[model samples]
Target: MAIESVVVRQRVEDLDAAVPFYEKLTGSTASRFAFAGVDLAGVGPFLLFAGSDEAVQRVAGVAATLVAADLDAAVEAATAAGAEVVMPVQPTPNGRRAVLRHPHGGVFEYVGPS
Candidate 1:
């Protein structure tokens, strides 16, 4: 499976305030989006998010989001390598995603075509 890009996840209290800083830091305009009632902004390789406590908690354990070339193949490979699925494949604003916890215990979210 080809790993496209790794997005560093940041949980912020206010997206409006955070977007500018991230955009400035990354030198890329923020791509605004939302999912599950949470506001999200993609600035370069960073993803900034802010929302209700429930939404925040839902993704709190995920250390990073990895863009995959094939979600199914990535999921299969991860599980085969001993990664446990924390969340099953689901549709996201951008594509489909699944959360997995690695054998060493870091949770990661993988995104790919729906």
Candidate 2:
């Protein structure tokens, strides 16, 4: 499966405040969405998140969320490559997601709509 893109997560107090800056920077409109009570949007490679402390903490310090056409393959490959699955594949509102810790100690989330 080909990796689609890496989306950087950033917590913000206000989605309105974040959108304008990211829009100018990416030169693209943000598509709004919600996941587990958290406000989510994408501008270029950035995934802006705004919500409560608990909601924001879920994705905080994630470093990045990797998107791929085939999340199953991605998870399988990660396991084969020696990464431990910290969060098993699970259904989300839009798709599936999982967290992994690489052999080198870096952690990241992989997500996609299967």
lDDT of each: 0.90, 0.89
Tens-digit lDDT track of model 2 for 1-114: 667989888888899898999999999999889987889988888999998888788788577999989999998998998999999999987689999999998889999995
| Residue 30 local lDDT, model 1 | 95
Give the best candidate by TM-score.
Answer: 1
lDDT tens readout by residue for model 1, 24-97: 88899999998877888989999888899987777767899989989999999999999999899999888899
lDDT of 2 at 96: 93
Give per-residue lDDT, candidate 2, residue 110.
96
Q: Which parts of model 2 are misplaced by more than 4 Å? A: none
lDDT of 2 at 60: 84
Candidates' TM-scores? 0.93, 0.89
Residue 3 in candidate 1, Cα distance off native in Å: 1.8
Quote the lDDT for 26 in model 1: 83
